[model samples]
Target: MLNQIIELVADELNLDSKTLTKETRLQEDLNVDSLDVVELVMKLEEEFNIEVTDEQAASLKTIEDILNFVEANK
Candidate 1:
């Protein structure tokens, strides 16, 4: 599941999979903007069939955060 999320985000962001890891900062390393984050979350919600609260959404700062969230929710 972590790998799949990473793959999906990497593909959407046009980032190299090698450069993306659980600890990678989504905005800092991937150059994702606010809009990109929103889109990414939406995609994740759809793909994982989980709802992300606004607060949870706001707290997502890194790939690890996303991975943890998905694991916890799923």
Candidate 2:
């Protein structure tokens, strides 16, 4: 699941997978802005088949947060 999430985010963001980790901050570390967050959440919803609320998306500050959300919600 971690690898899948990393690959999904890396491909979506056009980033190297090696640079991504659980601690990677979406905004600061990866330059993910509000639009990116929205887009990412959309992709995540598609890939994971789970809905992400706007508030939940806002609370995702790191890769670990996303992983946890999917793990719990899925």
Candidate 3:
């Protein structure tokens, strides 16, 4: 599941998957701005068939956060 999420995000961000890790910060490491995060959240929702609350989206500081959220909610 983690790998799948990585692939999904990598594809969405047009990033090299090799550069991503659980510790990678979407904003700090990937340079993902607010708009990018918003779109990514939408993609994640569609991919995982889960709803991410605004609070949860704000708290997703790292790749692991996303993984954990999806694991818990999906």
Candidate 4:
């Protein structure tokens, strides 16, 4: 699941797949801005068949945060 999310984000952001990892910063390393984060989250929800509340979404600060959310909700 983590690998899948990384691939999705990498594809969406036009980033090199090798550059993304557990410790990679979404904003700094992936260059994801606010809009990108929203879009990515939406993509994730679609992919995972889950919904992320706005407050929960706002709290996502890392790749692990996303993975944990998806795991917990699904």
Q: Pick by lDDT: which candidate is best?
A: 2
What TM-score does prediction 1 earn?
0.91
What are the per-residue Cα lDDT tens digits for candidate 2 across 1-74?
Answer: 99899998999899999989989999888989889999999999999999999999999999999999999999
The alpha-carbon lDDT assigned to residue 4 of candidate 2 equals 93
> Model 3: per-residue lDDT, tens digit, 1-74?
98998998999999999989999899899999888889999999999999998888999999999999999999
Q: RMSD of candidate 3 to the true fold?
A: 0.7
lDDT of 1 at 28: 78
Ranking by lDDT: 2, 3, 1, 4
Which scores better on lDDT, 2 or 4? 2
TM-score winner, 3 or 4: 3
TM-scores, in order shown? 0.91, 0.97, 0.96, 0.89
Candidates in order have lDDT scores of 0.87, 0.94, 0.93, 0.84
**lDDT tens string, model 1, 1-74?**
77898898898788778778889988777778888888888998999999988889888998889999999998
Once fitted onto the true fold, the runs of candidate 3 whose alpha carbons sit more than 4 angstroms away are none
Clashing pairs in 4: none
lDDT of 4 by residue, 1-74 (tens): 88997888788788877788877778776677889888988998999999988899888877888888899999
